[model samples]
Target chain A: MLKTIKLGLIVTLLLPALTYAHGPARVKVIQDIEINAPVEKVWGIIQDFCSIKDWNPQVSACEITEGNANEPGAIRTITLENGQQLKEKLIKIIPEQNKIQYMLTEPNIKAFPINTHGSSIILTAIDGGKTKVEWKGNFYRSFPGPNPPPELSDEAGQEALSSFYIAGLENIKKLAE
Target chain B: MHFHNTVILFLALGTSLHVSAAPFAYITNQGSDDISVIDLAKKQVIKTIKAGHKPAGIAVSQADKRAYVSNPESKDISVIDTDINLVLKNIPVGNGPVGIAVSPDGLNTYVSDWYDHTVYILDNERLEITGQFSVGHSPSGLDLSPNGSKIYIANRDDNNLMIFDRHKLSLLATIHVGKAPFGVTVSRDGQLIFVANVQSGDISIIDGKTNKVINTVKTGLFPYAIAHDDSNNRIYVTNQRDNSVSVIDLDKCKVIKTIPVGEYPEGIDIDIARRQVYVVNWFDDNVSIINTDTLTVTGEIPTGSGSRAFGRFIQFSDLP
Candidate 1:
């Protein structure tokens, strides 16, 4: 009877953990950059996920598994630093308007699990071959259970993501030139 | 051809003798998503022009008879025609454009892009963005000197006031002030610049000549806007969280009186002709009229519904 009571208490505590682990962690960052290129050139390069590996130092490979490239519902697997993987889906795409929106779908991070990820990239051509590329996104973590670790805080995560984008943009500029 | 030449000759004579008229005030209504045309002589909202999403800050150009409305959600500034009271064009600005100020000569309109931490310089005549200047984070309110020599911008994030030369659009100096500075106004004599520090609930007076903070005067909670009454040598500050207006004696650098107003007064304008103060209450949905002589609420003008839809930034002008 004593053993049964102890087991019941242990189950009560561990059951909540099991239920919480089912949901992925959430992370969000909103950033923008003004790229010096034509709107068409910037849009073309951003749409091709495979080219991201060439410019983005943190990203090793990106493969589109479903839907058309740059189209809604398109899924892509991305390999990040240290061979870690993340899956994302293109939720929206507007080529004529030079806007793209996407969300993270797979390889749910346990530390900073992404509950929802949405990004919008807009390209506006300014004078003298300059295109203002504004990239903004919101990330929400799954509620309940473990919170994001110190290194994976919203501010730090955004800084890392912005750096990656800056690197990729510099590469794009070099290639265009 | 003779008749056309005669008409052109009269037009040239008229243009040469043209007098600089008083500028019209363009007030952006965040709640209504429209711009209110205030005819200063009539002292009323003459017309409302539809603008982009969530219009907040407005700047008027006397030279071109145009107004720019900053719509944060839309990420653009809606350009309006003063004569027709209509949106003539929408110029794409940066993210979270909150505050706008036009040059004294009405040649350029400086828009503070809050989230992007940049100011977009739009050429008034060309109606295009000519240059961009980086400033402190989350710039909220902007004001230009009467002489059109310097532009003062209140950066909320850094709690600092940034000065830029109007001609070059180059950052001149950054003056530290109270916490969360929001509204900024330069005195008529060009000697003092008053900044409302929202978080500190006070106003910081900056010496324009020295480019340094001179004094700090306590205001009500969340002082959001400030305007100078040159005729009376007074400065009126709107306290949003406190729902009151604090009258500062400019010469003494002290609060003369704190008049009880409607809920969450955000925008303030002083009518020198009538010696009356018009304050837009964010929550009360009305414009509180205060008699400057008595320093009391004399009347109230009903505006939009809810706190957010109520009268926001107000400008008093004589233009129709």
Candidate 2:
């Protein structure tokens, strides 16, 4: 019994030499809404990557840099109503598919809820001349560590994203109609 | 018959990862302020020890014989005696300590202050900040070379990997990686360094000798951390967006398999001896244990809510 105990102790000491417990970022929010407008009309309102400021009241203005307006590598510098700014690069633009994908070039503190992989605004045609627009995204909270601050926590970020998508979709419907 | 059972036990213990000689894995529950002690051989959580608030980063000093856990919200580091499984001390450091790494010699521990943008060096025995040095913004994931001569840090917001000298705490080099670079790891032989870029959904593999990104391998959405299997030259990356882990073959530089795990699998570690990988699911509030050989989840052990076992969390110890 003594020998067994000693051996167990030795084995235990050497076990966790390289074991690491590193958490990857979490929190994914995919919000979608049905817009009572034709798919073509809805896509027209949100098609231009820089035109986000026109329909989305949250964005104060947008400036396009590099490549054509619809090019995949086109960059957009957007300033929100709160003076918050972000640099985004257009990854893809599939007009036939009614899908536009853009990635966050700078996921800085100023870009809080947008610190994620590229978000897509996909418009799918419905049978009743309506469109199902998805303003979905995958992201980790701005604050990486546990017990995040109120504004940067996962819950707070999720709420902000949900509200942003809902507000944008609601306004787009009103404008498209 | 008694002697025969004892003999059988010893025989079983001789093989690595046998059911008889499995080690204890200490997992930190961020939301619950507790630690889950798991018996790998039994594939179950045997104990839950209370800890400080929001335990995030962790490291083990096998030589000093203690496990250090960084509680970012509490702004302190908790020291747990590996043999006794009790909190020995809670030493305060800079604000927002996220990533932690202990030196190979076990005399000093390095902690990254995420908010302060500095790395604090602590005296292992005294648990006092002996030194600190500034680095890039949002220093999150940190790892040390086995020789304890080099340090690597993932600057989350800066989108770069910063290398430092272990002794002088001097800036060595900064290599630009993918966006939202978080978890950083150095290979067993210190010839390779891997960084999980959360926003880019890819890994930047850096050559240890040149400190340059040799290759970028695409993974599932939001890969947070990675575990390297030295024997097979395979890397297991935990993807948060899709709730899966991508198994990458280093030799081939491609993801060969993607294993689905629980919801929001964040923190991940492996017991090389048992050939088992343990992942903490944030949303599911449990630990998913994977049989590395088969690349399958063989068991799911219930744990505290928001279980995030980050850093060197799984300590192989004798259950006390």
Candidate 3:
């Protein structure tokens, strides 16, 4: 009975470690570019939520469903290149300040179920002749889901997310310039 | 006319002779929850003294023989008696104390509160909070001028360095640096301040006299800490992501060598007496000793459990 109790205690201590072996991963990417245009000009192109499909290469289509296009609490649906649809809510938006922040809300990607996606874009005038635009995103993932998937490694998932964001930003820069 | 001439001559000579000494490197070890005492004599961790919870940043006063260590979780500064290898007091500071620096006269210690975005000034003699000044968000590393007239703080969230007049506590300037500036150290001659841009993986060299960024030198991936060795005219930067140390020659403002170390090298300290460098690796739970002259790893000292306690900062003293 003593040996059995000791074994039970040992299993209890190791249970969490074994159960949480597979977890989600986080990835953050920041990109900046100096556009030879005024802040107003660059901001105008980025302010329209429906125009993301025109400028962003990866985003096939996007539409704001609720609230003003550039206002907080607005919901936007975006379709990726592979027909993966993602729904996001505008958490904060300030046109005068040339800042926009949004978080992914619905139609979660199967590879990153325990992930939160947030992105912020800022535009500032530099030397009156050019505008400096910065785009940054924070992607977080966690493990130990009810049903764990073998293909959801942290490194591979984060790499894919970072590359996707980079491609989208490059396309935006090309359109703005 | 002759009396006036004599007085002026004496003042001029005194000012020329009052050059400040080079600052000794101080590092706080978060893994051991203690401060490793490095004696420049042998260039080794002579002793490890207990401090508060998760000691991260360290500031030392060569004149007063006291070291102030910021304990982020404890929200206080652990005052260690340099001569005694013991924590004399844990003075309550602001929320999430991270960066710490002492004034030139050794009469005051300023600690950067990470959570509150404020710098708390502690009166050394009284051992109490004297005043506090607002800075940018998530202020982490700090450096004060040799004359105690200015203090520079690195705000991590804002990605900028803030300058403040030490006496009036007024804002001086805010210089935008690269992504996530975490550690800062001023040169001994008071001419340059080097800031480690963690996310950018580079070091920003600020012209101290001009208050401008002179240049940004690339280091290893995720450079988190920097230390200046005035005697050798070299700057040491610890790269957390690459687990390496980049030695920069101050004159050329270029990296001279990269010395690989254990996993996740985060904090660094230099021993001027023996011309050695100590780097703390967070994941490996050991300190890599490097010969500054040769720029190579000489030895390694294991601290504790091989967990990510982030053996973050390090400091050296002559006492123990």
Candidate 4:
């Protein structure tokens, strides 16, 4: 049994079949916030992949390790306030759709309790010049077996991702407003 | 998406069954642990059958008049009698059974164990395990040749495809493919083999006769399952991350079109009889029906949560 994955990330997105190949069922977390600002203003606040550190208070420090910010294949290492580091790679930046997609290039169980995580942030214009920010992610638990401890269980992974996205979205709304 | 289980209508076995039965798509919903049977003729869900925990991979066998579903979490396989649309038996297979396929004759069924790295052979009639053999790490997709002579297994971690003799269960050849290959398919004539590499985000086309890589077609991010449309001499691949399907022209061996689908599309199968393609979306919990001629999404039927019909999920209507 090979415990370590040869690749840094799981390419196939979310499904229980892929979960069987790695760990438990993949958990999906979606959090959104409405800000009293225009879509363009909100997108400008977090268009850069490295801007996550400025908007998300939990990310203490951020640096672009490879390629250019917001470009495909770009790698960024974000250091959390707790001192845990996780690497994420930019997959796409769709200006027309006002959506940005990225995934974790390195798994940090202590930080997120997940093996792999793919996420996207989208901004949609609503009524009254308000902008809606939605942060969504799909990830599997760090533990690879059927049974996992309380800290590394699926619930823990979901909770960690939900809280992370909620905090980020709230801050982005505040900043954009 | 919630489907009323009460509206499910069972097809009775007889002459009327053959006359009324149009092609049906069986979707294995992982989140809800059930199967959503979609009536292709009506383009709506016909029934929902409760399956084992975390049902994912599904293979339909017209010869056996049954469909086998892999439940990795439950560590077993659920056999469904297609006629009655009910679970006939639950056979415990291995540590983690993910990918599955039934032989052309419907006499044997192969199950891939992700954790154990083993392929188990089962007697479809007797509902018993007949043989088991080792393969590369994390076998995720299983496909048999048209003649049922050779079996194709995609080793996700090893980044390779293994060819085995269906009868002897002996290794024949191992060909290196792109990174993290998840779904595999063979042409109708068994002339070409297609492997969807998830990590590489491309499809490796192999010469079935020589067992060598012929060409590589780039797809949207994280290509998962593939569906071959032989009539149009093209193939459709589900891009999980891209939320779209890349239509590949077999003649040019290039992606001709990209059709946007629901979020997190995983499993895909072609209804050749109806000239339609069914793609299961995990995040959206719906199946997108594509018009083959137009290469556009014509309809979307809400299915159970985490709808992943990983294998050949569409049952032909001509079968009795």
* Each prediction's whole-model lDDT (CA): 0.69, 0.78, 0.70, 0.86
Candidate 4: clashing pairs of residues: none
Tens-digit per-residue lDDT, B1-320, candidate 3: 33543464466556543222322334565546776655434444556777776677777777567778888756788887554445767998876787888887988999887667799999987789989999997787898888888998999878899999998899988999999798888777779988999768899999987889999999987798887898888899988655689999978989999888986676676666667777777656577889877889988866642212222233333332
Task: Write model 2 residue lDDT over B1-320, tens digit each, in one string.
Answer: 33533454455446532233337677778768888877767767766778777787878667665788888778888877655556767989887888988887888989998778899998976668889999988898999998999999999878999999998888899999999898988888899999999878999999999999999999987898888889878889998756789999999999999999986677888777678888888767888888889999998988886777777776654432
The residue pairs that clash in candidate 1, if any, are: A25-A113, A25-A114, A26-A113, A26-A114, A26-A140, A26-A141, A28-A139
Off by over 4 Å in 1: A1-177, B1-25, B40-43, B305-320
**Full-model lDDT, candidate 3:** 0.70
Q: List, for all models, the DockQ compared with the true complex.
A: 0.02, 0.06, 0.02, 0.31
Name the best candidate (by DockQ): 4
Better of 1 and 4 by lDDT: 4
Model 3: residues with Cα > 4 Å off, grouped in runs:
A1-177, B1-27, B38-48, B304-320
Task: Calculate each model's fnat, 2 decimals.
Answer: 0.00, 0.04, 0.00, 0.17
Q: What is the TM-score of chain A alone in each candidate?
A: 0.70, 0.80, 0.73, 0.87
State the displacement of the C-alpha of residue B102, model 3, in Å, after optimal TM-score superposition. 1.3
Q: Choose the strongest candidate by TM-score.
A: 4
Docking verdict class for candidate 1: incorrect
Q: Once superposed on the true structure, which residue ranges of model 2 sit more than 4 Å away at CA?
A: A1-177, B1-22, B317-320
